[model samples]
Target: MNVVHILAALSEPTRLTAIHIIWDGGEHCVCELMERLNATQSRMSRHMGVLKAAGLVVDRRDAQWVRYRRNPDLPQSAACIVDAVIAATDVAGEVAA
Candidate 1:
């Protein structure tokens, strides 16, 4: 994955949080994310699109809903960047708390 593209996609807070939620190891549907993130359907879809374009996530069509999960094919280097970003965010959140 292109580091610049990935970083750019992750620049938004919603996209970053979406990545963290997807990384928690399950296929999350758009409706689920909308409720959890307090975002509208369009907003969640837009964020998911960014993550998809960045190659950070993969989606599956489940009936009327789209479910998202971490991209299993992501390279180790790119995955490391994702991990670091998530960890950094977690630390930052704790400090803010």
Candidate 2:
């Protein structure tokens, strides 16, 4: 994945948080994300779409809902950037709390 695309995808607060949540090493359904992020189904789906397009995440169809997880095929360099972004935001979140 292109570094610029990954960074751009994470630029939005909602999308950033979505990635943070999804990065927990488990697939996340859109409904779960919607509740956690206090977002509408449509809103969450749209944000996930952006992440998907950026190759930051991959999705699977699960009946009525779409589930997402960090792209396992992400290049090592791209993974490093994602790690940094998550770490930075994780710290920021802790401080804010």
lDDT of 1 by residue, 1-97 (tens): 7999999987777888888889988999999999977899999999999999999999999998999999999999999999998887763353234
TM-score for candidate 1: 0.90
Candidate 2 Cα errors over 4 Å, as ranges: 90-97
- Cα lDDT, model 2, residue 35: 89
| Candidate 1: pairs in clash | none
Best candidate (score: TM-score): 1
Q: Candidates' TM-scores?
A: 0.90, 0.90
- lDDT of prediction 1: 0.88
Give residue 28's lDDT in candidate 1 (0 to 100): 97
Cα-based lDDT at residue 41, candidate 2:
93
lDDT of 2 by residue, 1-97 (tens): 6789899988888888899888887999999999888899999999999999998899999999999998999888988898899887763464245
> Where does model 1 exceed 4 Å of error?
91-97
